[model samples]
Target: MKKLPLIMMGLLIFSLVPYVESASVGKASIDQVMLSLGESVTFGDYKIQFADIDQAWTQALIKVYAKDGSLVTSKVLPTGYSLSVPDNDNPLFYVRLAWILRSNQKILISLESELELVEGDVQINKNDAYNLPYKFNDVVIPAIKVKVTNTYENKANVRIVLPYETITATIFEGDHYAVPYKLTSDFQYFPYLYLYLKNATTSYAVFDVYLPKYPTTVFQLGEGGAGGTTPSAPGAEPTELVYNDIMYEGENLIIDINGTEYALGLNTVGYYSSFTLFDKDNNPLKSFEVKKGTGYELSEAPLVVELINYESEYKRAYLRVYAPRGTEVAPIVRDPKIEVSVSTSSTELLLNDELLVFINVENSGRGRADNVNVVASIPTGFELGSEIGTWSLDTLNPFTEMPVLVYLLKPTQVGKYELGPVVVKYYDERGIEREVDSGNPLSITVYAIPKLSVTGEAFNGTWGTYVHTQEKT
Candidate 1:
């Protein structure tokens, strides 16, 4: 009976071991949770609470605490902004305020952790090797070399040669194999390389490699002996490396020089291949079309690319790229100037007379004006007779004038009035709102009609007697 109890106790202890281990290393995430003021939630080893909110709700106060009941940080987070734990450069946890609902007195926040990804796909033929480079500080070194030994239908044999050891595996289609590696002496052995076989044929095989993390420092190999040193000599400048790689059409080859990342994309493959260079933001910096065995130099950015060879069957191009200088470019910005004028058909008019008003809007600047609106003001004694007071155009190009906007107005009362300084509102190309008005208001005069009555009493009434004036006057 005692032996049975002992066995049960041992099994219970073993079961709890994995649970404790998993909890210690597990990653925590919370997707967009709505929390009210003074609400709190616990995730992994951390606790997050919504402490307070401002009256305008534009900002919120958030408090974070560790599992040991100790406060980690208290921050005032703004809408559309985020607060990263331990700073942004090496963030382990993130507390982002997506938005706030003013009507409900609740806030939407998300807690997340940064994910480490180092995955890519490569195609290699039998007996060919692909080199993966590791960047430590400013020094670049060849970290691993992957070679294809053999390939059959749906399976390929690969050899992963590392600095310390070599590993071999047979990967079938849709399956993967992980190889353990240590980037530096201070790190533990992790699954640094994963080879996922996408397709395997007699000639070649395609693999998707995943490297979750890379070492910040590496062992240095020397002629005299093997020793550890800093990435480079003291006060020594970082050096650039020429990277050689093979890529198919639409595939991107990434290179980093002097902490700036550049991507070379093969747009088309032919006798005359075309490639485009992009910055880290994927903005095209330059483009080139060169024949095989020729090179191109980008003047805007200090980079050179040379095409060595192309395989028509595989649609792959072997390329060599390097950055020898710094980038030299400037951005150009243009402004839009709007001019408005108001004109009247006649300055002087009689009562109950109709007048035609014309509004001319023009863009005289170098940029285009968007969402142009023209507004006309009616005089005090005049009423709008034809068309509305407002006119709109989608866009007014530079040095362009819109069609004439004509409206009619009738004078309701006889008086002198001023017809208006028309107003124009528009947005520039940079989404800036601008307002412009006509230089001066147009003057108008309304005069009353003149009435003339001629009453001629031509009477030869010099005397009271009325004589027969047939002959004698």
Candidate 2:
């Protein structure tokens, strides 16, 4: 029994000896070696290579220091002269084993052949090449990576709104134009990356890429532009034209609304005799005429304004007003749809830090605005601090206009921005969710003014002021 056990132990040792020797010697002798970082490099006539299945090989050791060392990897190859090194840092190696001579099939026994370690510290050169005195124990590779980020808003889907009746005239010349328009406070647009490359202490190049241009439309609906037009009332008495109460100095009968001030076409000196004078009480008074000492009288008092009829093609709207019957006011039509017209007192502004967005809500349709919910939806990346009160309009107040204000945060980047389908989703007269009207889309363009800084002294020369190339000692 003891002899049988000893014989079994010897058999096991004999079975492992050949496998261990295979690392130092193979069926054939190595003729050439080509180490690749992540793939196998082809050697002349034969292809001896190995690859990492689960791990990467960062360093490799070849048996021969210059051309004599021979080292084999964990895997064996039938006929090849190459090895594949991975791109990550992991200790792995491969050895080439081929016949240097083909005449005789004499297998050479490479005894205890191990890859030689580097003698001194390795150094890398700028030419992307290396001058190593000794061979590496394992192949080393650098990790490559790719990354991308989205910095632009959806441009093609953005909607831009213009003020009502505001004509945005753009003359395209040479395939480009600089157009100007007002932007709503809730505007949010795409942002692009600006790359700059500099060599040493000098700038080399700058790259400006317009991410993408989004689709946009004019004004929130029923305000101005292609929509919002209607015919004037036939035989309708002229409503008192109450200009904003803002007045300018120097006895000028002009009133400033918003930011613009306008004057009556004629002087207001005693023109009220032919003109009719009426008070809010609908009572007529002769003293209301523009006397020699009296300047222009107040055109009209606070009146409820509403959009009665809207004509899209003419871009006009008819308004019904309950005015005092005593004023001899000439009803001048300013609208293109009718002889009467309207001039807006609104101005476009680029607010970088803060802005006040105003939304006016009214019911133009014949249906009563019961439970009318006007929702102002802003774009992403914008913040609404708090919900200001509703337009304080009574359901009983017929033909009423209510104003809602929203404060907008300034944008960091410059571009065209858009906010909402100002949705006016409310139940119609039948208590059904039947209305699908949208407030006008608004557009705002954020811009940046670049600043240039000059350093050091100057010298006047022909080359547009010679600059010092180097620092003074």
Candidate 3:
């Protein structure tokens, strides 16, 4: 039995040794390494070589090779420019040229391996510990551990345990704490761990943590070209407008330009896709065929319609409509739908009587309403008595209602009068100013008091008035 226990222990130790040896220690990184022409330096599986330099010394050709001595990539890197190995999107490493010295025929460059960043959200109970795993290329390495020690009132106390030291921090909701840690055996410390407390309760807490597998180095290059002006590099594309929604077949996209509403409709027949422009009354103005991923400008208007993609089975077309020639074109999208209501304390009142008017506004859409201005029309027979004619609000969030706007109005002349259709002007989330009316007007009736007068003559039909003790009949 004793020999059997020892054999099992030996087998367990043998199983863990290969896994420890197979784990990667750290990422390869070098900075400001000077290499002469045809000279190469090896970093892990990739080798960087200074292949050739142009006669003007403005550009140099660099080549990268894999460990099997096979060429991987060749790029002519300009001074002060960088080349990402493999490609820019999923770059394994980066090669940045610092400067070219004609005097010594040498090029200064730097190589840095991409750091692997891992981020996730963890929900932990109070006094429970969560181990944060550091991964490099999907292989787990040594990392720190975090424990939620205490949580009170919207704040959480956490303890971070590293291989060398431990740290404690008190963080509120939406607060983040960054701790320096070493991912490898090397002493280089990096702010490799980030803890963000998203929400915390008395019994439990939710937080997000960000961990990087390796440390990084930032290099500052000197000014290049004449007068410290860097020439524009090639392969930079201009930014194009992106479309968010996919329009279905037979759908209309309405655009408003300088008080005119132009409707653009898309319809596909067989293999052909056509966009038709129509007036506000649905009268067709012009129609043109647009290919996929191509832009077609309307001859009737100064607008361009780009077809991003088309799905025949789903009858959907992804399109982007804009003004290509710098013409101002505003597309009519879903905005903050604001509805207003106006009410009064009493519909009928006497002359000089004040009427209490209440105006309420609500946003029923997903967009926000900004710079809202409410203008109550003062009728011909009434005048404002208390508040100003216009009321302003800085912002009204979506699905929210503003406080009732109250104003007093006194009837100037006694007659049947119409009170309101309060005009509301505001800017939507797109900064486009829009106007809306209450639509329902309040009808009010003001009555004037009757006057009674009597006169008596003392001289009996002589139209002369005499007082004292004598009574006139």
Off by over 4 Å in 1: 1-331, 388-390, 459-473
lDDT by residue for model 1 (1-473), tens: 01123443354343221101122222233433556677675544556777777666656677777768888765666553456554445555667664454544666565544323344468889989877656422335347899999987667888999888888888767666766555344222244456778888898998876543222222222222111121233221211225556667777776655467777788998778899989999999888886665456566555656666787765767765544323222222356889998888899999868899888888887567988888788889988898733377667876688867899999988877987788899998888999999977888999888998744332465544553343433
- By TM-score, the best candidate is 3
Better of 1 and 3 by lDDT: 3
Q: Which is the winner by TM-score between candidate 1 and candidate 2?
A: 1
Q: How accurate is candidate 3 locally (lDDT)?
A: 0.64
Arranged by TM-score with the best first, the candidates are: 3, 1, 2
Ten residues in sequence with the least summed lDDT for candidate 2: 335-344
Sort by lDDT, best first: what order? 3, 1, 2
TM-score of each prediction = 0.31, 0.23, 0.33
Cα deviation of 172, candidate 1, in Å = 57
Evaluate model 2: give its lDDT. Answer: 0.28
Candidate 3 at 104: error in angstroms?
7.6
Query: In angstroms, how far off is 122's CA in candidate 3?
Result: 1.0
Score candidate 1 by lDDT: 0.64
The candidate 1 region of ten consecutive residues with least summed lDDT is 16-25
Off by over 4 Å in 2: 1-352, 391-397, 436-440, 455-457, 460-473
Worst ten-residue run, lDDT, model 3?
Answer: 16-25
